[model samples]
Target: MSEWLQLPFVQNALLGGLLAGILCGIMGTYVVANRIAYLAGGIAHAAYGGVGLALFFGLSPLLGVLGFTLAGALIMGWLYLRERHRADTAIGVLWAFGMAVGVLFTDLTPGYNVDLMSYLFGSILAISRGSLAAMAALIVAIGLFVICFYRDLAAVSYDDEFARARGIPVTALQLLLIVSVALSVVVLIRVVGLILVIALLTIAPYMAEKRCRSLASMMVMSSLLNCLFAVVGLGLSIRFNVTSGPAIICVASLAYFAFMGWLALRRRA
Candidate 1:
């Protein structure tokens, strides 16, 4: 373990985990408060198209993924605002379309040989310093946004009507939330892959919510849980020569089940 920690790549993975943990905690909370798990999934799978585009254009895949997902998020937010009745349907359409675009574009790329598994399950050790910087920037941006609009976001998340009565720009805030989710999704994809990203964005907060009395407390607890899972998972991956992303996510799932079992046993007692 000590020897593994000495490796540069291992250090990068640890840093990535720390950054990812923070982003996941914040975005996960937003997803829960807004009740947008599926919407988050939409944004994540949609970012695959951006990955394909990036590969085709010789650009940074992460940047491409963020751009494409953000665009999709904005469009989805607009449609939802315009017709709340059809928000789910609109998200479904975009979700399927974004996934198809990514797959189709990847297939069309000439002589492009990329490992699909890395994007699906994550290769945290493969994360570069540049990616870490991007993740750090995202965390800072999200922190700033949260600090600036905590109250309005709280009201909007819990009750849009009340938020509006209080003069909150519900539409703009929703847009911002969607964009934030997109950014988080981009960073998370590198940690847990698109297939399992939503779980990371959701499970920690869900667990923390069971014990926390306030949203602020929930966020703090979730961040701590996320960090623990990331560190333990990364350590296990290093010890066993397994993949870091899945290891991290599996740790989270274990924590989820453990908490549930404990709760059930306590209820029985």
Candidate 2:
């Protein structure tokens, strides 16, 4: 394992995993607290359209994901705000449409026989330094956003009606939260892939939520837990010659169940 850490690719994977974990931890707190996991999942799957578009047009796939996901986030955010009760129907539509668009574009691309599994299941070991820079920038941006609007976001998350009564611009904050989820999805897709991104996003935060009394504490603990999972999973993958993404999720899943069982036992006691 020490020898693996000496490799440049391994180092990059570690850094990427940490960055991804932090990003997911912060954004995922809101995702879980606000019950927007389904919405976040929609944004994630919808990002595949960006992948296909980028492939067809010979553009950077990450850029394509960013563009498509932001657009989807905005559309979904609006639909959620305007038709809260019927939002799921619209989210499902966008989710399916985005994936369909991706598949169509990939089919149309001439001689583009790239492995789709990498995008679907992630290739964390193959992450580039450029992607790392983008992830860092996003973390900084999101960190600043959270610092600036911590109280309002917290208020909105726990009680939007009360937040609105206090003149907290609940609608705008909600839209920003949705957009933030989209950006977080972009960061995580490279680490966990779109299909598994939601699990990484929610798992640590979900676990932390049960233990922490405050959202800020939950975010901090979740970030630490995500980083731990990444390290353990990466190590396990190296040891067993398994896929890194699934290995990471497996670690998180096991921990989640263990924690749940502990809580259940304590309640029985």
Candidate 3:
């Protein structure tokens, strides 16, 4: 353990894990409360478009991903509000379209993008200092958003009809929620990858929902749980010489299932 922490890569992975855990906990609460788990896949996969664009244009992948995801999130949120198309259907389309765009752009790039897998499956050990800073900034922004709009968000999340009656900007807040979800997805992309992002985003929050009475409490508990998962998963990966993202998700899955089994037994007893 001591030896593992001594390595720079391990240290970076830990830092990335901690930061991702915090953001996921915060955002996951909203995702579950809003019943928008599907949105995670849409935003994450759509982000791949940005990554491919960045690689092709020789720009920052982070910027490209963020821009593309925000656009996708906005579209998803808007589509959810309309009467004609179902939100899930829209999400499905965007999910496939985004990834397809990424692949197309990557193909058009000067050379085959060898590092595409890193974004797809994550590269936590390779987290850069700039990535850490970006994560910190996003976390801060989310914290502030929650602090400033707690009442409105809570009202909208739990009861949009009631919130609108109370003069809350329900539509705007809904859009904001999706955009924030996009940011949260970005925070985890480097650590967990697009494919596994939903697991990281939802697992801790799902488990915490059973134990917590309030959304705020759920966020706190979920954050702690996510941190534990990240730490334990990272340890397992280091020992087994495997990929960290899937390892972390595996640990989380075990814990989630264990908790469910315990709940079932408790109810029976």
Q: What is candidate 3's local distance difference test score? A: 0.86
lDDT values of the candidates?
Answer: 0.84, 0.89, 0.86
lDDT of 3 by residue, 1-269 (tens): 89989999899989898888888899988988888888777888888888778778888877888788888888887887663246787789999999988888898998665477777879988888888888899999999999899889999999988999999999898888888989878766766687667876789999998988888999999999999999999999999999988899899999999999999999999
Worst ten in a row by lDDT for model 1 = 190-199
Please name the candidate that would achieve the greatest TM-score relative to the true structure. 2
Query: What order do you get sorting by lDDT, best first?
Result: 2, 3, 1
Which candidate leads the pack in lDDT?
2
Angstrom error at residue 32, model 1: 0.9
TM-score, per-candidate, Cα-based: 0.93, 0.96, 0.95
Candidate 2 lDDT over 1-269, as tens digits, reads 79999999999989988888899889889999998888888899899899889999999987898999999989988998887888999999999999899889999999987667877778889988988998899999999999999999999999999999999999999999999899888877866687657877899999999989999999999999999998898889988999998889899999999999999999999
Candidate 3, residue 237: Cα displacement in angstroms equals 0.4
lDDT of 2 at 232: 92
Number of colliding residue pairs in each model: 0, 0, 0
Q: Report model 3's TM-score to 2 decimal places.
A: 0.95
Q: Write the candidate numbers in order of decreasing TM-score.
A: 2, 3, 1
